[model samples]
Target: MSEQSSQGDDDPGEPLRLSVIVPVWQEAATIQATLQHLASIREAGHQVIVVDGGSDDGTPQLAEPRCDRVLSSGGRGRACQMNAGAEVATGNVLLFLHADTRLPGSTLAALKRFHTSRNAWGRFNVRLSGKRPLFRVIEWFMNRRSWLTGIATGDQALFVRRPVFEALRGFREIPLMEDVELSARLRLVSRPFCVTDPVVTDSRRWEQQGAWRTIFLMWRLRWRYWRGESPESLANAYRSDVRNAQEP
Candidate 1:
């Protein structure tokens, strides 16, 4: 949702539309499917952009045919990679999605509906990789927290107008919470709405580490960061393994 700033004052001919940017680093195993899903999203009129952050496993080549534009990223950090993708995107609305995410076909339509319903911007609900009841609890609590606080994450798939994104100068390029930092800014401008449906996110990291331990670490690290812990500290705490079946 936006304040409707003259409906594209700069482009009289182009209607404000959605642009989805997916940042990836060595996600070859999962990138192809992600791109295919993105390609299917075009039927809803959303443009998908992929920014490959020096993936050595031919991830860029795999995404080339499916994405409208596939560009080289500045670094392997998710924040920097996403910012690089945004730099070349032309859509009026930008949605930052994860490589392991599976957004619903109705997502773009829901975006239109939300934008028309209220003057706010937001993210969709989240579903975990497995049907573990515990994981479901995590997802529910996270969604509720986001709805209550307007704080969304990259994995939740954030969508914003390009001009607003540019005005905010995009992501902070930090190793952590690039999504959190960006969401904070979006909340400052407008409340983020939640789509009724959910987007399933891969829990590869959790799988690599023990799920319970990963969850505990995530909660502890998140609290630490919110309490003013440095990004490097959090990065050190984060497990950087990509051993799951879906990750490359």
Candidate 2:
């Protein structure tokens, strides 16, 4: 489907309209459920756009019916796919959501508060879907770390005003750390409007690789990234680690 030609009005006096942009690859299994969960947002007059990164599966086909627009990323990578969706988004606020993440029930109310507040960007707190106590510890740290440093991961449901997003030129088309990179630039504009409500992210990765192993792997990756290691190298290392974890 073609993108909506009109860019929605950004009049300060008007109520904020959220445009939730989801980037997907081979996520057919979870795409439908994710979109279904956003039905309330759509019913409230918000828009949902799904960008596909050349998934050979029926991801786009499955998503097209559920969203306002389904665009081809014409390539892979979350940064690139999200940028493509943002380009055609008509809402004043753009929310980048992960395919495996579900926003809180109070999302609209939280966003309304954010819109009225003097903030340019923000992210939701996040929790894993796992019921284990370890998941609670992970969630606590994730939320606390984001609150202290003002850096947000994609799983946190990052949202920013369209103008600010445009000013930053959207997420950099990097192989990794795109969310962290964007957060750094966004911090120059304003402290993040941290929402107390949490988005629930799938725990499949942690379950598949083991929670402690996954946590250490993520910490090592972030540490290396902070040390100025190339994103390309980090991405390779991450993929290698995942592959190794999956080996029986």
Candidate 3:
């Protein structure tokens, strides 16, 4: 092999080797800000890749400048778009982030530090960006449930080593609950290390839908899903109950 190729083959030890992949659809309002946050971590050998799932809202254009690579997905599903981003990403680790979520400045460095352990596949705790007191209660419950069950939601900023992600064949192509499904599969590899440093996420959904109602809806959906209801069915129910529920 050529010298450059040999050097590239060396494992990334004690350095940031992460790719922040944001799969978006019609996220023009938030994609730019999310990319900007990820841009700050690029100096640590981390890269950002935005996968636009056939967006018509200029999301790709806004992401092109702030992120390292912006690619258009052939389909419009969170799982499919995330897998597409991973296919072209070069980092050893992949972080699947949402367009409405913002990570801290130390996110890349934290991931590198966590990578030193065997359980590198994990997610950060989440904080909702809303003034409602119920948001706090909901976030606490979400974080606690995740820590206890070792199953993480997408809003938590799920991440995993590239090899393990590929081995698990990326996320299942489901209409909803893809993150939960991936976490279940990943449990065979390692229990997710829930980082306490929270990722701040937009609380518009909870606010618009009414926090208590949204919480109950989610619980019902999960219970039905656990009872063998198809993701498509759950997705339909979610859309009927929640405004802008089709969003990724």
Q: What RMSD does model 1 have?
A: 4.7
- The digit string of per-residue lDDT tens for model 1 on 182-214 reads 888878887776775888899776666667777
Q: For each candidate in the order shown, give its overall lDDT on alpha carbons.
A: 0.77, 0.91, 0.83
Candidate 2 clashes: the total is 0
1-248: candidate 3 lDDT, tens digit per residue: 00000011323564547888999999898776777777667765678899988989898898788889999889888999999999999888899999899987667556755566567488888999998788899999999898888889999999998989999899999999999999999977888866777999999988777788889999999999989999999999988886554445
Q: Which prediction has the highest TM-score against the true structure?
A: 2
TM-score of each: 0.87, 0.95, 0.91
User: lDDT of model 1 at residue 71?
Assistant: 85
lDDT of 3 at 123: 88
Candidate 2's TM-score: 0.95
Stronger candidate by TM-score (1 vs 2)? 2
The TM-score measured for candidate 1 stands at 0.87
For candidate 2, the per-residue lDDT at 159 reads: 95
lDDT of 2 by residue, 1-248 (tens): 11111123344687989999999999999899999999999999999999999999999999998999999999999999999999999999999999999998899988877777777899988999999999999999998898889899999999999999998899999999999999999988888888777899999999999999999999999999999999999999999999999999
